[model samples]
Target: MNPTARQYDTVIVGGGPAGLTAALALTRYRHRTLVVESPEPPRNAASRGVHGLIGLEGATPDELRARAWEELGRYGLAERLDGRVEEITPLAEGGFDVATDHEDTIWARDVILATGVTDQYPDGVEGFAACWGRTVIHCPFCVGEENADRSWAWVADDPDHLGMTATAFRAWTGDAIAIAPPWLPGADELRRSLRERGSDLVLGEITRLHHTDGDLRAVELADGTVLERQTLLWPQPQRQVPLVERLAQDHALALNDGYVTVDEGRQTSIPGLYAAGDLTGKPWEQGVVPAVTAGSAAADAIHFATLT
Candidate 1:
């Protein structure tokens, strides 16, 4: 260990909603906490604003983060360090040593892994960059109600997913279109359900998207067929960040479907090591509100565990 390594009660990796929330709770409890955030933009950086969070509805991601940092500063128990965690080594002495890109080492009695996931968007799709988060959304509930009654399209990797997603989009609008790529699986039941829901199906591979100023106008197919749509629901897959993976592998933390496995209190399999937020492998808990709740819960658990 470095002779000058800073020590804290807890060291949290990642500064997204989960990490910041945990830091806030820890600080409020007067626990010495250190938050290490990467210089890179968060996964939700492309989104214009966050949804599903009351009192902060429509708040941009940047705004939410800025406000969170300000709140965390009030307690003076938590400090933010701008750097990426390169490695986390569990010390035999019962804490952990965290190494960062800034060449600084931090030792903490407990480590909280709040590193979020990364979204994988489709490649070679025109206008995707501009329309993403604005018109090209993933979860219908996230941006669906905001763009309700508009022409909506659901893009999925398979016929079953397309049918299911399109059917769900019907809650927001009646004019839902399922973009069924040519490679989609042939499922009569799914096709029937789509038709039963009055959702139109476009059978072709999307080659490009036509949009203006982040507002989607239409998607062009490989056959040059253009289907007009105002909003698109394309659920992108998510993967854990490198730091989470490294910690899981190095510490032998349990994982389920690539997400960290945590007990009800957000504690990982390893004692003194905890996890929170999206990395917890719960699909229904991927939103901002849930992330905040998970962080607070993890802090509470850690506090209680330390007392014993």
Candidate 2:
């Protein structure tokens, strides 16, 4: 190691549930770990509370993150750096050189990319962005109960995902209104299923979403008609983060259906590199347990590999 080198047994590229959990596990193993939390807010930043995560139910995103960081603080082997990663370079000997936007560079024997994913919002919908994570949510499991019992709009970018999202939202609301084009694949069957469940379907694109800060009011249709609603559930398409793109800038980063492909151990195609959390699969499938499991698994894998 260089005389002034900042080195770690492993460097984690996110501070959300996954990265934090991984850091906790690695530090508990007495390994030096550094967790880099991006300056950007988390995916559910606007949601008032987090659900489906036992013991931490109803905790807001800010609260959950704060608690996670505080817990990691109890372990002295972990360090937290708040900055955006700009570049990552593989070393000739081994390990990685990670550069951040803060003009800081660090080294690690291994890297875990819990970097997460970014949602691609619809372009022309009015107030959709503003209402997202507030009145408009991704999963019913995220903020279901409080936003339940009333009519809610469910938007699906792909028809294949329509049935799954529609069924999930039905647990909270009886009258499920799915905002999708009628021509998409599997539309008729999904529509039939909705009707069978005493729910309704809205076939077409969303023109606008009307909502307050934490309450939805209505949804406007392309035909100049509006439906009263208090919540809008959307499972939009998600893309990988910029760090993944930068890693693939010169060469192809192996992706399976636009997600970073990892083995059972959570290591990516590249050796000494790994990815967990929503970056490895559907972003909406994220919660505390899954994040913790994936993160801890990666930490254990790195530890066992190091032992040999």
Candidate 3:
């Protein structure tokens, strides 16, 4: 069933840290906002603290969201709906009509895309999928502290990405190992860095992952040797949602490899549409800090819209 329009000044897509953060910012600016969030939870590792944000280091992601939600209530301008946004149409009145999976419509003067990205893990890696956000992770800053002093391994499906992952993991663990696939760049440098960092460099094809009840125990190579490790750190390739692709097609929204492009102010290519967080495509995906900053900037830009 489709929902009818409930008037709002801004409609934010996604309910994770990015979307939630943006909702808070919009309310603080006193803009009536509707945040449409799916019931599905993020698969990323649980965050202990939001890094790179001054004065909020070591604060859990949940804690940050809770605090922000409380502040947003003071402004009386935000509402949350537990449903997925199915589509968005630009209205003739210089606003947008956002349609949800439940058929609810939200009419807003502006739209904010806080929809995040998803990582596609390589295929045929047994037990690998189960270890995600647990012993296997993409962001070191998000999961490294918990893995401190544990035997860590960097597994690459392609040799080219080995050096990059290996170099990054060195800062976290001296016991780290780099396992490269065939044809990657800078092998000697990667090996040297591993040695200098007191880590190991294992170059070969990974045969399989040996685990006990989804807890990673070791990585089995083709040679039949098991490398003992408690955690695996690597990046996963991501793809954006089709709704964002349509957003770019209908509007002049700029996209870099399918991610919505935004300026320092977080405004999208289209007027009144803003983007932030993972959808904005920063190099490192700095977690909560990026989401919060982008959201605040988007709200500030929308405030300018009222003045103009």
Q: Write the per-residue lDDT of candidate 1 for residues 1-308, one digit (tens) a residue.
A: 55688989999988888898899989888999999988998877887788878788999989998999989878888888988889888877788888889888688989999888887778888888888878888766677777888898887767656756555766788788788767667745666777876776767777899988988898998899988889988777888888777777777888888888889889888888888888885544587878889999999999888788
lDDT values for all models: 0.83, 0.80, 0.74
What is the C-alpha lDDT profile of model 2 across 1-308, one tens digit per residue? 33366888898999877888889889989999988888877886777776667798788878988898788789789888888877777777888888887777688899999988898998899888888877787767766787878887677656565665446666687766677775667778877886776665667767888777656799887887788888877767889888898786643568988888888889887789988898887756676668778988898899999889
In candidate 1 the C-alpha lDDT for residue 223 amounts to: 92
Instruction: Give per-residue lDDT, candidate 1, residue 127.
Output: 85
| lDDT for residue 154 in candidate 1, whole number 0-100 | 80
Model 3's TM-score against the true structure:
0.84
Residue 253, model 3: Cα distance from true site in angstroms: 3.2
lDDT for 24 in candidate 1 is 92
What tens digits encode model 3's per-residue C-alpha lDDT throughout 1-308? 12456888889887666777778767777778888866776533344456666776766766766676777777878887888787788766678778888876668888888888767777777787777766777778766786776778877655445545445665667676777765557677678766775665776666677777657789877667788887887677877776787777775568987678788778887777888788887537647767777877887888887997
Candidate 2 is scored at a TM of: 0.90
Worst 10-residue lDDT window, candidate 3: 42-51
Model 2 lDDT, full chain set = 0.80
